[model samples]
Target: MNYEEARAYLDSRVSYEKRGMPESTELRLDRMVTLLEAIGSPHADFPIIHVAGTKGKGTTSTMIASMLTGTGRKVALHTSPHFERVEERAVISGEPIPGDRFTRLVEEIASVVEEIDAKLAPDQPGLTFFEITIALAMLYFSREQVDAAVVEVGMGGRLDSTNVVIPVVSVITSISFDHTNRLGNTLAAIAREKAGIIKTGRPVVSGVVKEEPASVIREVCRHLHAPLREAGPDFVDQYHSKGLAGGRVEVSTWRRSWPPLDVALPGRHQGANIALAAATCDTLEELGWTLPTEQLKQGLRLCRVPGRIETIRRHPLVITDVAHNEASASALVAAIPSRPEIPPSSPSPPRVLIFGSSVDKDWRAMLAILLPHFSHAILARYVAHGRAVEPSTMVEDASRAGIPVLTAETPARAWEEALRLAGTTEEPQEPASSDLDVAPLPDEPMICITGSFFLVAEMRTMMPLAEASVRPISS
Candidate 1:
């Protein structure tokens, strides 16, 4: 099969990412286990670091993989929701899987998938897109003889396809109210699903500091006899400063204390993720891996996750981030340069917010947090996926948030609208009161494209030199 054919084969299966999870579909790891058994149990060939969380798991996973690679180890990093290409989900030593290799792997797995489909029980669901992808990644990593694989859970940890592997260390980042319908609504309930990755006698690195979630992780660890390394108490990250370039943070663990280091990813929230990655590396060292301090520092300085506060353009300062929910939106708002507080009497509009989100997300709450940071918002639907919340549905939310809103048919059109708005500026008028806080605006206005990964992906395609960029994929 060629690349296109492989894509078609994968797309034909049931994908919860494209279509919202159906109540009729029962999520279980049995199907994944059966498939792996039929394929010679490739997941057992290497050590794994399983990561699950609501927000920062992907970043944390990438950081771990990059650091390991910096130590001259061949590491396999598997993440979900590709932005541009499907191969982005599987990375070996900082490079995406080649198209030809991906196609051949899909062809190899096709027959096994059919064989399993034929023997399934009547009520059992067939292999899903996520399950197949995980199997393929495992098979490829085994074939390549990777030293370690960092697998980021696609969803909740208990039944996620990636959960089949026995990881050396399980990492759970912060937990919040994302996917509340599937994973329980409360923090404790959600923490239960995330803590499912903690195995018997294995060590766990948890970034959850909230009492409700942290307590859940602690109980699970205690019951399983697993070592627990809580973020606030065991390891900590202190934020130094943030800029358009990146943020500086100082990380401290039981093993050592590191000076303030520049994190490639933006946002002060990444301070926690960096600390988690550092602590995980410390655990790996305890597990008999040689990771030098300099190499770890190099990995942290050079690592980049494309869509997380990525600046695609210089003029007008177009930034794209996948901040789909309330916590992420709040972080994005805080990470970006502080907006000049416009007085009520000012006529010119402030910075532009180009946004979209999925139907399952708490978009109303997200808007409440995001709208206050921008004077105008251009709403659009991402065409790559079917779960986008309608632009019209959010009109009232924007109005209630006291921000003027405009709707576009698609993400591309939204970009057009944003550029048009950013290009025009009214003469600067003196404030009615001298007491008002007024920060000077740059010569080029700023535009932020965010909300959903699909929206960010679509906007990314419109950026200059986009094809030559890192070519990000999503979950």
Candidate 2:
């Protein structure tokens, strides 16, 4: 089968809601591993860093991959819930493999899957979308012989297909209430699900510092005989200072100490992510993957993740982040540069938020958490699935929050409204600066495109940011 045919084959499978649990469709999935084994367990070829978390896993994974790549290792990255392209989930050398390459790989895997199908009994479902992608990434990584791979678990870790591998180090970034319908509601329960990646005797590194959930991870590590390196105490030491280019940072870890290190990403969460990445590097060192310090540092400085505090323009700058859950929304709100407090000659751009999300999400809670930062907001509907909170209802939620909200039937229309409102005014205003000094917003109004991951995916296609993908950059 060719690429198009392979995509069709995968697309013909059930949706997330339709498929529900893998076990329900167990009869259909027997050949997934069989197919992989037939192809030679490519996942076993490389040292893997498995990451699982509700909020910060993506950032943490990106940081670890950046550090490894900086060290000149050919690294493979597989992150889920792609913002734009399906190929975004799998990256080689920091670049998204093209549609042609992805299609070709899927075709190859499909051929093997077809061959193994006869062995499966009836009433069983076949591989789902994620399973196929995971298969492709592992097969591709193994075939290319990558030095290391950074994997972000697609969903709850235990049943997650990515759990099939034995990783060198398992990293759980931070845990919070999310996917309550699937992963559970309480922090400890969520922690248990995230802790599933803890393999017996494998080293697990985590940034969890709170009480209930962090305690849960500790318990699992003890049970598994896995050494759990705590994020702050055992691995990372924090330092902060002012910088000329961006902000100054201090990162002290079990491996090394870099006080007043300059980091580009904004917010305290980023500081945590950096620390986690450092801890990850330390864990790798123990396993004999000693990378040069310069590369790690340079890689940290150079790493750029889009749709998560991505700056699009200057002067009314358009800062976009893909923060959907409560914890994530809180972080995004905290990161928005507040207009200067000091009296100035000029005024700041109004903070306009353009939000959208799946219908099942806790939109009320998510919107409430971010009410402080949004001077004005608009809600957009889902473009992919019809089951999204309507923009009109979102306006009602905003009204209760005492924040004015505009609405659009679809996100594409919402984008135009947000733009107009962000720059909209009955009259013009001036600019200003301050000494106690919060960072400044850019020339254009900041548009935070968030809610459903699918909405952000659509936004990237409709309104492209400067440039970001899995593809590597050339000098």
Candidate 3:
């Protein structure tokens, strides 16, 4: 198929998300393994590092990939919930694969779609956007003959589409409640799902997880005879700092030096993520893989994971984040710079927000976590894609949080309103022809773009070429 036709066909694959795994993907590993076998065993082409967790998986995956690249290894990476294209899910040597190569790879993958489908028979759920993306990464990595590949679990580690591979070392960053309807309800149950990545006899690295959940993971490690090294228990973060742009942490384990580590992504959560990445690096050391300390530090400092507390423009300093869950929203709030320090001469501008979310999230709880951070909040729905909750209902939910809010037809217009309020010179001052026309104010107020990952995904499409590098904080 041609490129546009291939893109359209890929878009059709999104419908498979509705076929939610009724049981944990971990329990169905046998089936996932069989599926891999039918595909010519793509997982065996190179060494892979499998990572899982709720919050830090994406960040940790990037850190690990960045570190591997430091050693001059050509690496292929696969992570999910793409803020842009399915192609963004696959990266080689810290850069996304080019579109022309991506389309050609997809065409090759599509050619095998019929064969893989027939192999599954009744067990087939059809290839999902994520599954197809993983297949692409495997195919691309094999074609490129990279030294190693770092793969993040698409969801819960065990049954996640990426779980079919046998990784060199497994890393579980941390576990928390997020995909409750799909993963599980409680923290322990969720940890159980993430623990699915642990392979027998493989050494695992972990970070600070809640007690109950850690206990669940501990039980699994014990059962699997998996050697596990935990961040706080086996290693600890010696120093932590927060700054206007972001912060750094110095980690000290038995083997690692007290090195200052920078994470371009905002949040205290990232300190934990860096420590997890450091610990994974230590695990790689045990496997005899060498990493350059200077390059590793550079990766964390310069690494850009879009939309995760990413700044869009200056003057008013517009920021965007894809913090959708309660824990993450709380982190986003803390990560927002104190209004006072942002502008030394200019008077502080009250926080204004353009927020949206999907139906998968707890509307009330997510709003409660973020509402207080803003003086004015505009509630909108991410209607362009699946799982969007209505904007009107979000406005109602924001009201329950006792915050002043307005509903918008779409996140795009909501963003326009936010900039108009900021009065940024780079933006159009007047509202477009629509049911709403927010008065354009001075471009001094700090505005944030947040809510669903899909919302952030759409926002990136509207970005200028220079703004394309910024994306939601992802693994």
Candidate 4:
């Protein structure tokens, strides 16, 4: 099958990321196991670094893979919820699987997938889009003889398809409230779900600092006899400074201290992620992996995750981040360049926001956190996804928060409106009663497009040629 045909085959399956997740009772791992067994269990061919958390899992996974690659070992990195292409979910040595190779891989596995589908029991669910993708990634990595693979759990760890592998070192980043309906709402409950990746006698590196969740992870580690390396007590990261460009951080562990490292991803929260990646590397070293300190620093400095306060344009700086939850939204807000000081005579440059979110997310709470930082917001729905929350549904919330709002049918239209407003030189005005009041447009305004991955992906496709050519920094 060709590339388009392969994409169609995968898209035809049940996808929780595209459609909303079903009840937690319906989640099962038997199908994933059966599918892997039929395909020779490729996940067992290499050492794996399994990562799971509510936030920063992708960044942590990328950092670990880059560090492994910097040591001259072939590494495979698999992440989910692709921004532009499905191939982004699978990478070998810093490059996405080529289109022809992806097509061939899918074709090779197509018969087995069909056979598995044909034998499902009445109560059993079919293979999902996520499961297929994880299988394909493992198969590709095994075929290439990768030294290691860093796999990010698609969601909560216990039932996630990526959890099948017993990793060399399991890394759990900051735990926060996300997918609360599927995972439990309390911190301890969520921590238990995320801690499911901790295997017997394996070491774990965690960034959870809160006692409620940290205690859960600790208890699990104790019961399983897994070595636990907590963030605050085992290792620490210090945030030196931040700017629109990026941030500077220094990480220290019991093994050694590294010089201050420059990170391409911004946000004070990234300090914790960097520390988690460093500590995971340390644990890998303890497991007899050869990773020089300088090479580790090179990986930390070069690794970058797209859509994490990523600046796509310069003049009137335009940023896009996939911040769907309150914790991530708070981080995105904190990372935005603080309003510049202006003379008493000049008005502060307006901060324009283009926002959208999924139906299951707490969009109102997100808007409450984000709207205050901007002069006004342009709301739109992500056209490609069916789970987008209606833009009109958020108008009352924005009005209640005393922020002007404008609605658009699609993300492209929202960008157009933001550019039109940004180009205008108008004085700030008092809040008006109408819902569509976009009155205050200032000269040389900065824009932030955020709220959902789908929205950010759509906005990214509309970027000018110059901005679109800027690649993410990694190995």
Candidate 5:
């Protein structure tokens, strides 16, 4: 079987992330367990770093993997909700597995996956796309004999398929109210599901700061006898400053202190993520893994998370961030350059937003945080996954909230309209026409494209040669 055929088969299965997981039903881990056992339990072959949280887990996982690889060890990284292609979820030493190898791994597991599906109980759904994908990652890691693997939890941790591995150190980035319908409605409740990744005697590092969620995590760690290291009190990061490019900060942990660090990912919150990565590396040291301090610093400086607050253009300042929830929306809001911050003598560029969101997100809440900051918003739908909330629905919500919002049939239209509307003093700019005559604004405006990862993926196609790194496109 070829890569295209393998992807087609995987896409045919149900996806819990795109379609919400069944409410109030226990996630069926039996299928994943059976499939793994039949495939020789490849996850047991290497040490694993399991990461879970409402947000920032992907960044933290990528950071840890980069550190491990910097020490000259072959590392495997498994993350979820890929921006552009399915292969982005499974990568080795910063490169995705080869197409031929990905295809072969899928073919190797196809028989076992089908056998497990046939034996599922009547009310239960069979193995999901995420489960099969993670199984494939573990099998590939075993085949390559990686020194370590960093696995990010798909959603809530207790029943997540990636939870099958008992990691050397489990890291939870931050607990927030996302996927509330499936995870929980309250902070403490959501933290409980996240805390499920903590195993007995395994050290756990958490970046959760709020008292409610932190309390839940503490309780879970106590019950499981897992050593707990909190981020703020145990390993603190002093954020000196930040910009659209990245930030500078100093990370101090219980083990030792490192000089000021440069993180390539934008947003001030990444300082805390860097701290989490540093703390996890300290834990790995206790486990007898040797990562020199210089190597860890090298990894922190060179790491670049692709779509999180990614700047794709400079002239009009086009940026794409995959911040889909209210908490993350606030982070994106904080990262944007405010007009007031510019010296009064200098011209401040107006911020214009092009937005799209999934059906399951708190779009109203997210808009509440993001809209007021932008001069105006161009609302659009991400149709790539068929999961976006309708653009018309966003228009109504923005109207009810007394915000200026314009509708676009698609993300590309929204991008064009934002470019056209930026720096204009006009009230409520209309949708753009192909040949509309308008003068460029005297000062360039910053255009932010955000809402869902799917939207970012679509925007990537429209980026110019200098804007994006060239890579193989999955057909």
Candidate 6:
């Protein structure tokens, strides 16, 4: 009936994220379906928006919830992989579930969870950590009488516990190569798993652009007779600008067009994410939700996700982004100032990158995508439930990529070394340039710490004044 007890109960359950999905456990909806049925099917009490994809699901979900909440509706947003605390997974009206309330809910559900587990066979692991989390979110939203709930798939969609909900609109963000072992190897294969969220007669919005994956989604929509709205020609996001500060884009849907909107998240790819959220809202509009352009713009301007090109410091700039896979890694690199091709001609400040990755991730592809952009790289192991790829493996990857790298004992040490390397100015400086043609002295050398969410969370804890939860900064 307290935070510690709740945490201990959750920690004891089978966590697929911590211990990679096992062959012994079956991935199916039967358990969740039964569990919800036993608990009175709380998810059916309210309308839901189901989101699934390899990336951008969290951002898109947050944007939709923000807009709904801004319109004076009580919204529930459920996401995964909490950066600081477990309570982050279930938020109502832009606020985390209160500790006392969470404790009461945990106590309330313990009996049902025990009853279900007791009925399962000895060899079967019935309910997982993720499933319990989903149950808790649904129960809480139903109890609170929320107007709507935004549920993000914890992983690949088909068998994900959150799939138990029949959403009013299903949104699938960009699909890429991630969790290949669990999902599948080819894009088409991955798209098949992601498309499982589509339901008969439910409107589906897809942001997947790869030809193969797009084709798969189209076929699934056609077969299911789900109304499909693609992001390319049907919904458009025209890029305006992108930088560490933020990004700007003009999003257009069939219903309406908005002027250049400020996306608090950095990177041009976020333009696509914003467009996806817009399309989702437009779908809700058809479902009879009152969402005006002013409210939509307010929500877009107010939504900011931390650890995604998040700036923690200004002087001797220190940035932290969670770019674990190859696709996200490329986006992170594009956000940073790259080294000029002609060394001295259009010189950028010295770049130092501090990196770490999961043992199961595509290190070779990620390293090849990111290492060349930095002048110096520091590699280290991150502390997390899953093991980090060893520095030796990183060394080999960097060597094959023809880039020099320095190793550290831990992420904290890597941060320290990055600061030391970034501050060092050994090269003799050219005489202060009075010529206007010469770009005025570039800002101090940049330090970018990325590669894993654990690394960013750890680094944020070390920085002064860094809070566990982050929201958009009002300019």
User: Highest TM-score among the candidates is held by which one?
Assistant: 4
Question: TM per model?
Answer: 0.93, 0.88, 0.89, 0.94, 0.91, 0.91
The global C-alpha lDDT for each of the candidates, from Candidate 1 onward, is 0.83, 0.73, 0.72, 0.84, 0.81, 0.79
- Each model's backbone clash number: 6, 30, 12, 0, 0, 0
RMSD of 6: 4.9
lDDT of 5 by residue, 1-475 (tens): 8889999989988897677666656576777788899999999999999999988999899888887787888888999988767888888888888889989998888888888888878877778899899998889999899989999998899878787888999999999899888888999999999998999999999999999999999999999999999987899998755566578879999888978887666788888888999999988888898889887777766776777887665556667889999889999988766654556788667677888988888989998888888777888887776678889888877765455679998876887787677643332222232111122234657788888888878876776523222221110
Query: Between 4 and 5, whose TM-score is larger?
Result: 4
Overall local distance difference test of candidate 5: 0.81
Query: For model 1, how does the per-residue alpha-carbon lDDT over 75-174 read when each residue is reduced to its tens digit?
Result: 8999988878889888988888899999999999999999999999988767999899889989999999999999999988887888888999999998
Better of 2 and 5 by lDDT: 5
TM-score of the candidate numbered 5?
Answer: 0.91
Candidate 5 ranges with C-alpha deviation above 4 Å: 24-26, 340-350, 400-403, 423-442, 465-475
What's the distance in Å from true for residue 218, model 1? 0.3
**Model 3 agreement with the true structure over 1-475: per-residue lDDT tens digits:** 6778878877887443433345543244554455456567777989999989887688778878876676677877888777666677778886777788888978877767767666665854666666677777787788788899999887787677787887888898877788898788999888988998888998888784578888888889899999988877787774354443556787876686747987655577777887878887887878887777886776566566777776655445567788878778888888776545445666547577888887777767878888877777887766565567778776656886665677777767877777666655365222222201122134347777787777877876775522323432222
Off by over 4 Å in 6: 340-348, 424-441, 465-469, 472-475
* lDDT tens readout by residue for model 4, 1-475: 8899999999988899989888877788888898888889999999999999999999889888887787878889999889788998889878888999899989988889889988988786678888898889889999899999999999899988887898989999979899999889899999999999999999999999999999999999999999999998999999865565567888999788878877767789988988898899889889998888887778766776788887666546677899999999999989887666678899877678999999999898899899988887998899986899898988888777576789988987898888776674332121222311122123447889999999998888876423222444353
lDDT of 6 by residue, 1-475 (tens): 6789998898889988777675524887888887788778999999999999998888888888887777777889999877777788888877778888788888887889999999888978858888888888888899999999999998889878888889999999989999898889999999999999999989999999889999999999999999999988689998765555577888889888877788657778888988998888888889888887776777777776778877655445667888888899888888665554444665556678888888778878887888788778888877766567777677876776555689986877887787677775232132211221122236557678888877777777777522312653221
Q: Candidate 5, 247: how far from true, in Å?
A: 1.1
lDDT of 1 at 170: 94
